[model samples]
Target: MSKPRKPKGRPVSGWLVLDKPFDFGSTEAVSKVKWLYKAQKAGHAGTLDPLASGMLPIALGDATKTVPYVMDGRKIYEFTVAWGEERNTDDLEGEPTQTSDKRPAEEDIRALLPKYTGVIEQVPPQFSAIKIAGERAYDMAREGETVEIPAREVEIHRLTLLKAETDQAHFEVECGKGTYVRSLARDMGRDLGCFGHIAGLRRTLVAPFGEERLVPLEKLVALEEIEDVEERLAALDAFLIPPVEALTSLPHVRISDDQVRRLRAGNPVILRGRDAPLPTPEAYATSISGELVAIGAVEEGEFRPKRVFG
Candidate 1:
């Protein structure tokens, strides 16, 4: 008997969900996979801290153009926050800044969790990617700069306290984009009369991608699996939004070979009969037939292409 031979690589462009390994930066992992797949382009849907692992969506080739779609997708995470202790960075990577001999009962954690749900204000950790004064916040923090970052609004759609250990509280959170789990743990501590830091963090889902669909790094790095690897890529139309999202008055244009050419050249051709959903905050190109050609940003009533693909 012979093992099933995998395909060489995906012919069409798209995304793949990865179960990221701990201790690896998103850029490092992306670089490795992008090279292995020989993809002309690649990027992740969202970022996960090096200590945090799970569901990292990697876009390939043309699919890279749809990154914004995935970036805006909600994320789900399961984490273990060690309570009664505080860290400078709010995670295992930071040094302990404080600790408490007191412990919060499981019931206490449960009762306190509801206060974080829904829209809330949160201050991002000083050691974060957020930009401050034209430099990365983390950079300033590392250089020993002390600056107070104002609290901003972030939505925590669902935050459930799943369990409580002697020194840790396990939780699952489904939150809107930009919600910082690091800050969540820190603030949660202040709310509970103690300090806390993330002991373990894992992302279970990023909107369309779930844990079940995730492939681990070890499996992906197997050179033996190269054959048929292309089949793993998501379809080109995977980024397609509902027709209701189309622009009014751009009524479907069945792109001819010529139109495809012009659009490929970066021209915003006219669509007859108009009638697309109001241009979204960021515009996207749709064919006369309504297939997404590229994402566009609307300016002065015209949609200009941003990221385009064949």
Candidate 2:
């Protein structure tokens, strides 16, 4: 019999909240983080365009299992909309497809906020990651093929205009998953009779992670200068937040050591006591010592393991 190939790199696990710099692609950022950490596996919670800068939560090793939880969380973005021209891609990266000389007044912009604040249908930018007929939309867009992209509902929790200028406007938005800020600028421009595109965009928050947890790429790169390999790895490891941090929005249960062993072995552990939680579709279990053990479901007073952590 042939031997199984072992995975390379350390089995390090945790979340690295990177303050991605402008012009950096999300996939590229993940590669860099994985290489720096020398981890066996790594993945990012959400995709951020090259022109966009901000919080890009990266998961390494076993933490990759919790990425879906973080990606589903609310996001906050601060962006600047440059009026007078609208681009094909809906951002500054694309060629101008439409132009208008009219500038919207501050009152006019404020009046338009209410319309976009609630759940509304939005057409994603043509140059986006959305797939069409099994091909990426951005790839088709780059080939000069314009396809009819359907509009879908996206919830905007809050949209606030912070400043307005003669040719540009700055705003901050808190929105749900899959909401595109680029589309916001494009649609608002068309409504106000002034063409617009995103000139600057920065993500400030992603659910459980906030600006406080963000570590700039440069700061992490600097740790590479440490003389000893072990010390350098330790320094890099210091920035990793616990994997449980990403599951803050989900129901959590602390189990006994015996329960932890059962859960890790892919067995259900009965919940005992009057205060036991009711049935839930999803929840995470931790050891009595507070270490993440497994993500599972609670049903009929039993915690059934779905994804056990190593």
Candidate 3:
């Protein structure tokens, strides 16, 4: 009998901004893009719901090392909420659990926005990916168990009401990590006296990437059908955002070749300049050649490598 063959894929690296399609799960979206690039490693910055679509940053190989930074970045979402009914899952995919005959006026909806804006406590939906007893909260909810998740503080920088109708409302939100739009919509409905659930959800921006950088799945699918591997790969490479680009928001210090060598070897090097502004404890250190050397912390005027790129 022949031995089982292992799959062949490239050791490709960098990030792909995927315009995830509606009804497609984040994991499946990552898998499809990984296969398209034939990457040895892959991961995503944020989990976009299957019912939601837009900006899902897929990181391959070395880029996966910086996913934490991307996830910590602020995100912008534009969603529509359907009024008069509340769903078990807090989204349109769930069964209706309650209904109301009231619809808040435009002025009333505007008044409610301020309460949700700024720093506030939010309880995630019962059908969320949050962990409960080492199992997913959604799994417990699907099994018909009541899951009570604790309310946690989240920053909502902006909450603008884009439009309003008797049965539906559109809004845009810019928030920090851990903010759930579903929860926001659900609570808004409750506060307004008309039950609501997220009817449509789309993430428009995740720091370091925005709508302009998003490449649709259809484009990658087209590349996959090409017979020539080199040609296909070259074409696909055009979509790659350099791995180091993920650290753009961080303060960067240029290092000499010797310092680069020291960083790659996991050593700390003293930085000079009495007049220069002090770097943040955590900052990106790059080579004079514009290549990322390491993500390091400044301690006593020394750049100490925390994670080296090589």
Model 3 misplacement above 4 A: 1-8, 274-279
- In candidate 1, how many Å is residue 38 off? 2.1
Summarize candidate 3's per-residue lDDT along 1-310 as a digit string, tens digits. Answer: 9999765788788999999999999999999988888898899998999999999999998889899999998999999999999999999899999999999899999999999999999999999999988989999999999998999999999999999998999999999999999999999999999999999999999997888999999998988788999999999989999888899887788889998998899999999886333767788888888987888788788888888886
Write model 2 residue lDDT over 32-90, tens digit each, in one string: 99999999999999999999999999999999999999999999999999999999999
The order of the candidates by lDDT, greatest first, is 2, 3, 1
lDDT of 3 at 77: 98
Clashes of each: 19, 0, 0
Q: Tell me the tens digit of each residue's lDDT in model 1 across 197-309.
A: 99999999887665677778887666535455444433222332232232332333244455566777887655444554344446556556656576665544445566666
Instruction: Go through the candidates in order and give each one's C-alpha lDDT.
Output: 0.75, 0.95, 0.92
Best-fitting candidate, scored by TM-score: 2
TM-score, candidate number 1: 0.78
Better candidate number, 2 or 3, judged by lDDT: 2
